[model samples]
Target: MSGIYIHIPFCKQACHYCDFHFSTNLKKKEEMVLALAKEIEMRKSEFQDEIVQTIYFGGGTPSILQIADLRFLIDEVYLNYKVVENPEITVEANPDDLTENRIIELSKNKVNRLSIGIQSFFEDDLKMMNRAHNVEEAKKCLEIATQYFDNISIDLIYGVPEMSNEKWLQDIETALSFDVPHISSYALTVEPKTALHSFIQKGIIPQPDDEVAQEHFHILVDKLSENGFIHYELSNFGKENYFSKNNSSYWLGKKYIGIGPSAHSYDGKNRGWNVSNNSLYIKSIQENKLPIEIEILTKTDRYNEYIMTGLRTIWGVSLERIEQEFGKTYLDYLNQQAAKFIEDHLLFVDDNILRTTKKGKFLSDGIASDLFLLNLE
Candidate 1:
């Protein structure tokens, strides 16, 4: 089954550590929504025979849209695309935008899941991230949202500068108190060109310590595991039957259509991304042309991707699939490259499935990179 990802590229305010494509301007919001709907309609044939199982509204802030705007887009998908009867439609919302009424409205309009950007429950942490919500609003929204939605996920940030281990644990505890099914926690990263990066460069804010972040990650894994949550991915924790279908589809390399500015789409062979500019995206779509760049995946490229994504999830890379699909040469190359890591206890082959050991989980990306085949022609 395929999925659809709609990127809403507008935010109420910019977060300090965010580098995602978005605009603080709302003037083009209406035009952007229309463009998004058109893009969905235009790309219908891309997934003509496939049934859509998930529709994700991710963004600068999807909750910034009015109910009518959201309904319009959802209805557009239903009308033009082949979707399942009960597709998992998720909307990524900020705590500040999820009012009591808003939660109810979203439920009525086919949005079965809510991924709230709580970030942190502490006021100082919120301010440090320049989040739009305060401590009370974060807690209040979850209190209200949990009443209306069962399949809810909240994002939390750990390893902020000056945020002690005690505070991080408190954040985890507060999130657990909500009884939500899923939690997507990430370390506070200092992306280049972001306000946080600038602050660190100017010595106004301290840089994030890798040791501190690693410590927080372990704490998160231990706490979530103790509370009946599965550490399904490096950054995601979910209860049984509560994993994010949309993101899971993506990690499994299922084909998906991404609509709107700066969105990425993939078929089995080609990957494409929309232009990052809002006005340009709208203008191009209005002209019946897609504002996207495309890349055709080579066999080596696909194998590398499989290794990268597979290593990060609970389902580790399959050696049989590798040999079958990528041929014996690629499989041998993988085994050869991974031999050292396996011997070091960073990775292991169990039942022909290559997976990272607990000691290698945090460094899975680096290990996966080391196994990549370069310049395969």
Candidate 2:
């Protein structure tokens, strides 16, 4: 089963730490929405009759769009794709947009899940991040949204400077109190060219400390585990059966198509990405062409991808599968590379499955990078 992802590239305001492709200007709202709907229709044949089991609306805050606009996009999908009978449709939303009327309208559409962006519960943290929503809106919106949607996942940010341990605990406690089904918490990183990067460079804001971030991560694991929330993914916690199907598929290396400016697509062999510029994307589509870039994955690229994604999840990389897919030579190389990590207790190797230890999870990216194999051109 394949998945479809729609990107909405507009936001009310830019978050200081975010580097995702988006525009804060509302001048082209209607044009972008209409173009997005057109893009969906245009890309219908890309998946080629594969049963679409999941559809996701991720963005610059998908909840910012009007209900009618969303309905039009959903209708277009239904008209074009052979979507599954019980497909999981998700929309990424912001706290300020989840009004009672809005929630009611969203429930009426095909959206069965909401990934609310509630980065933090502290007013100062919100202000520091230049988020559009306040602490009260962040707290109240989830409660109101629960009336209409049960498959809700909320986002939280950690590692922000001045985000006290007590405050972080309170944030998690508040989210837990709301009984949200799923939570995606991430550490804040200063990406280059972002406002946060500039602020830190100019000493306008304090930089996040590595030790503090590590401490917060441990705190998150302890509290969520005590509260019966499974740490399914490193950044995601879920209660009951509320894990995100769309995101899970991606991590598992399933095929998916992404539509809209700056969106990405992967087919287990090749990856494609739309042009990041909105006007160029729309104009190209208007002229009957897809303004996108494509890259064909080589053997080593595929193997390294498997190592990176598979090692991070509960499903570890399987030696037998690697030998079967890539060859014994590649498997031998992996075994040789992983020897030191296993010896250091950072990786656990048992029953042909290789997974990161709790300690290794913190340095997963670095470990994965070290394990990457470069293809000689």
Candidate 3:
């Protein structure tokens, strides 16, 4: 019913498009891992149940850690918490780090899933994005990974300025050729303060075109569907029994404990996030204090959250849960707000489930926000 997320705050190199909390300096990695283990012991009773179904190693390339380091953390989880027998343990990885030996080592530690970061299968695209791995490395890793883990997911970035439609199609084809179980694709967004954003601003790199991104999006949907992959979420596609349980819990608003620096945790009612600074986080945990910020969820906060998270998935928002959690008035308000969208062929209500139509998926956030109750105060 509950899950855990551990953030690894180190990466071999920083990709220009990455805005994640990570550092290339690995001087504090050993200390940070030990600190994270201590934090887990401290926060063991945060969740009511001791049974954890999923343990996700996410963030600044979890694949960079040594096998023993990862095994030590898993041991700590077992010692401090009553982990479920068949827990889904996933590690987010980069292509270059996933050698055949490394994959075999990971498998021995009960790491059931591998989420590889293979943005593109072309050298030019990889160089343009400043990715550490090349196309050959990408293919080799996936080929080696399939031999070890059946539940493999690879990430792809679309809408890069240099990525032509033919190249994009080839990327999809290349992924399919790998026969990986899951694929998480995303548009290359230029977030503020990122090297990519600055490059675009300075005309050193062309800005991503919204039109091109949308074209790629449609292609993704069509191609993935044709390939027997379920378009389960806007950014995820998977075969039967291959959906990411760790990520699914997030969209379903399930409780999860996020450990390590810059990790976030939520328990349906309230949410908390660890500090992003590694040194500060380690220092605080060493002092037997959690470096975190907490927010208590209000009725309106819950309502709006339901809309935002639920509408993004194929499940959509449940009116029954809304009525039970937020009362009947909120449901009425949602229906009234959705009236315009329904007429515009963007949304529909069926069996008390408010879901987005095909035309609405692209603008799902905007539509969901329109139905949000902002008078939380």
TM-score top scorer: 1
Best model per lDDT: 1
> Which residue segments of model 2 deviate by more than 4 Å?
none
Candidate 2 whole-model C-alpha lDDT, 0 to 1: 0.88
lDDT tens digits, residue span 123-210, model 1: 8889999999999999999999999899999999988998888989999999999999999998898899999999999999999988
Candidate 3 has its poorest 10 consecutive residues by lDDT at 44-53
What C-alpha root-mean-square deviation, in Å, does candidate 1 show against the real structure? 0.8
**What CA RMSD would you report for each candidate?**
0.8, 1.2, 1.1
Q: In model 2, what is the error at residue 356, expressed in angstroms?
A: 0.9
lDDT by residue for model 3 over 236-327, one digit each (tens)? Answer: 99999999999999999889999999899998889999999999999999999999999998889988988998888999999899889888
Candidates 1 and 3: which is better by TM-score? Answer: 1
Candidate 3 clashes: the total is: 0
lDDT of 1: 0.93
TM-scores for all candidates? 0.99, 0.98, 0.98
